[model samples]
Target chain A: MASNKEDVKLLGMVESPFVSRVDIALKLKGVEYKYEVENLQNKSEFLLKYNPVYKKVPVLVHNGKPISESLVILEYIDETWKQNPILPSDPYKRALARFWSKFIDDKIINAARKALYTHDEKEREKGVEEIEEALHLFENELKGKFFGGDEIGIVDITAVLIAYWLPIIQEAFGAKLFTSDKFPKLYNWSQDFNNHPIVKETLPPRETLMAYYKGHYERHVASNK
Target chain B: MASNKEDVKLLGMVESPFVSRVDIALKLKGVEYKYEVENLQNKSEFLLKYNPVYKKVPVLVHNGKPISESLVILEYIDETWKQNPILPSDPYKRALARFWSKFIDDKIINAARKALYTHDEKEREKGVEEIEEALHLFENELKGKFFGGDEIGIVDITAVLIAYWLPIIQEAFGAKLFTSDKFPKLYNWSQDFNNHPIVKETLPPRETLMAYYKGHYERHVASNK
Candidate 1:
């Protein structure tokens, strides 16, 4: 492993929520590193070398070694930094944290995309239901101020996209599923998550995300037509 | 945490490749525990209480605490029983092991199912192509006699189902994909993985698996008709 701490760098796209998860974790842990935005359409050779399997971004290079998958990278960060620990100390608690983090990434992200992108009524309804069911489970899981505890931890970091990007997607798709009354706990949690110091500073602006997504949706519709 | 090691109980089904993964881990770690096969069609309250989220089997219950998700449970077992480490000691290597493990579960499992079960010709072809691609990737990642280097670690455990069940499914479906010439590494790796002493002893017999899958496919086909 390379010894220089300054060698730590992140390769990602600007508007990617997955990249935003890594960005918030780094800022929260107070780790300083260089950020290089790769043109996802024309991926750089460095990015390809770092993550050949997925060919996706949000690859965290520490000590000249690459760690892909945002959840995996987050755990690595927590283990390496050992400051403002995102994962819990107990082994069982850590497992639970990892479970919920995977839950968000595996279930919510894809469901939300289907809900927004699928034009078919039946498929769109199924997507909406999946998102609602997952969020409901999360709402029940949250008993303290955050998913982890009184402070933000791994699960909250995994939920960056849900808190920040979901509203933009809802507006673009004209679907209002996350009403405050129906999911009061989750609604409140999203507000708290977005307001967190590091998260607020680092999360992409809503307008920027909205413009980017609107264009994406328009392009998708045009292509389909 | 449970003080008594004997309190470790695994709730699973006999034919489930996932359940076999936990069994292999327990046997390798030399952690003695009771294995209860659940009736998946009629899930027991114990299984439901332990894994309320996904409502699936292979729930590892230690003392009274329950950990779901086979990969999460594998990590937990590794942490709990340090005798035989299934994951790499270095954090970076551990991350790569997990990356491949997740790749296999998220990509290979679903693709293999689609390839075997889907009736649509185009979709089935796509699934076959996906399985071929993913297996090739696994083939390349293999080195030093095992994916985890000279020892059966997390990735090998994750590939348990693929090694044991894929051929059964292929035979039942009348499809041949993993030719020895086309995928020499993967083909050899499967043989090595299946022949591991603990795995060999614990893995469900091929005849049993074939009968179980034959019934499953018959039911699926009849329902679709």
Candidate 2:
């Protein structure tokens, strides 16, 4: 458990799924910390100083040392706090968790981003195909209730984008990429994940997310036109 | 130390820098393992079974369980072997190492690949600019003799591409993108990294890599035309 003496601060934006990941991890570990929301357009000097390389949010500053990258921060939080272990104990299982977490980020998220945002019809179609294929793999891999096998682990944490943000973004764009019919298992898993106690509290309200993503989608469409 | 009872096997292709990272980590840990070279053009069923998601090389199979992704494999090896510690002990330091390793993969490698292989002059120039900016960040980060300070660690292991393959790739393409003058610290570090005993053993022969890359570059150019 994190001690009261420890000074932990998270620089993030309310709407970022990445920031939500850190928040959920800290909450799972029963650790309390300061959440300083950053305006993405004009990032603060502190955020830049902390994460000079990427200058992005979800930077976890513990005792004045900054750890950037949400996935990296999740691991750090797990290691530092030790309770409600986010990753598995066995080396092979831990490797599996890391592999799935990375797949979500590299394959699913990237393809979903393209599918939701791209103006080109052909490119958007390709992106949708790629994301479905990637999601199908996840659907096949889900032998248990959740990706974490009855518990919310790193894979489930990293897949927050797929569970929460993807649906909202698709709604905002008036697109149907991830359907319950096509991916029933993944759809169910997302439902369970969203309803998880910690995740429920950590996630932004649906209406708020819808409003934000709608504005973003409209701006993207306007700019393209 | 890995015992003789441990059944370890590595499925890899000779020329891949990603494969070399696993090889170097295995050597550094003094872990005895069988190395099976895979013909990437006609990938074996074994490779497909082990890494169905990516169907890529550098899959580490330990006692029947398989681990894919070079960075994921490196961490698995470090945890399993518990010798020649590839990653730092402290949580914060480990996070930093993960951060930089990811930067090398996501920014530097992606940009370098585009710069080296892109058919369009504008895209190639853009790639060169992106790679240079990314490398400048690395150059600034290199405060010691090595990224790991005194010993070779995961960051240095992941950076094998920049040390060995990049120079050969540039020469094969008849492009001089990574000049020593522009990044003296990174250049010196690369030289040191290349000369390290484990890395020296793990890297493919210079002529062999040059021959392979030259063939690849020619094929790419011919196909683009």
Predicted model with the maximum TM-score: 2
Model 2 lDDT, full chain set: 0.91
Report per-candidate TM-score of chain A alone: 0.94, 0.97
DockQ, candidate 2, vs. native dimer: 0.95
- The parts of candidate 1 lying over 4 Å away from their true place are A1-5, B1-6
Enumerate clash totals for all models, in the order shown: 0, 0
Say which docking band candidate 2 falls in: high
> lDDT by residue for model 1 over A109-193, one digit each (tens)?
7788787788887998999898899889888999898997889998999887778887776776567767788799888999999
lDDT of 1 by residue, B32-82 (tens): 898988998899999889999999989999888999988889888988888
Backbone clash pairs for candidate 1 read: none
Return the number of clashes found in candidate 2: 0
What is the C-alpha lDDT profile of model 2 across B61-165, one tens digit per residue? 999999999999999999998977989998888998999999999999999988988999999999999999998998887878888889998999999988888
The lowest-lDDT stretch of 10 consecutive residues in candidate 1 chain B is: B1-10
